[model samples]
Target: MPRYEYRCRSCGDTFELSRPMSESAAPAECPAGHADTVKLLSTVAVGGSSSAPAPSSGGGCCGGGCCG
Candidate 1:
């Protein structure tokens, strides 16, 4: 089973569920009993080294931000 995050449009509530991969795309019922829920895009981080370099400051035009 994998953990999936869902957001309910009716009550504006967020929750998590553990279900089979085959049902990953299936609709989830909110804990508040709302059926109008959709799965949320989740962020996953994978790392094995504590000495990993920190993320850059994301400065300049290289990033989406302008270099103003």
Candidate 2:
């Protein structure tokens, strides 16, 4: 299940709901029983250690003066 954020225009309230992706676009009622609501764009945060090796400081042939 994915969580979605919504804002109620009637009461100016913000809420979140967890539902299937199939119903993500379905209308949601606010906790205050307001049907006039709109779904808000969600932001995702990703964090992790990269597996790729870092670039070498000793730049390649150019830095080694081999290109000249």
Candidate 3:
């Protein structure tokens, strides 16, 4: 099962549900009992050990330091 996120339009509430992928697009009820809800695009992050190289501190065109 995968977790899906949703937001209620009627009450402006957000919630998550775990269900089968087949029903991933099914409608869900909000915690506040609102039926007018919409599924949200979720993001998944993949990370590794701290030993991995860190991102550039100044990622701008010439590195933020050069511009500054």
Candidate 4:
């Protein structure tokens, strides 16, 4: 099952649900039984710094910031 993020407009509650990918969204009813709700796009993110040597700068480095 995949996780879907949801926000309750009625109670202003944010939550996550684990359901089948086909579920599409969770019930509008909030945990508190509020009917006004909406499914939200989760903003999951990953953070890391790659030290594997930066790729060569396009156009090659020159005395000016913009060089070709």
Candidate 4 segments exceeding 4 Å error = 44-54, 57-68
Candidate number achieving the greatest lDDT relative to the actual structure: 2
Ranking by TM-score: 2, 1, 3, 4
Per-residue C-alpha lDDT of model 1 across residues 1-68, encoded as one tens digit per residue: 79999999999999999999899999899998999999987765344447756656885356736655
RMSD of 3: 8.8
Best to worst by lDDT, what's the order?
A: 2, 1, 3, 4
| lDDT, model 2, position 7 | 99
Please name the candidate that would achieve the greatest TM-score relative to the true structure: 2
Backbone clashes (count) for model 4: 0
Name the 10 consecutive residues with the lowest summed lDDT in model 2.
42-51
Candidate 2 has a TM-score of 0.65
Write candidate 4's Cα lDDT for 1-68 as tens digits. Answer: 77777788987998877888777654756788887878886555333555576656553456335565
Q: Could you tell me which 10 consecutive residues in candidate 3 have the lowest summed lDDT?
A: 43-52
lDDT of 3 by residue, 1-50 (tens): 89999999998988999999999988899998889999988765233346
What C-alpha lDDT values do all the predictions have? 0.85, 0.88, 0.84, 0.71
lDDT of 2: 0.88
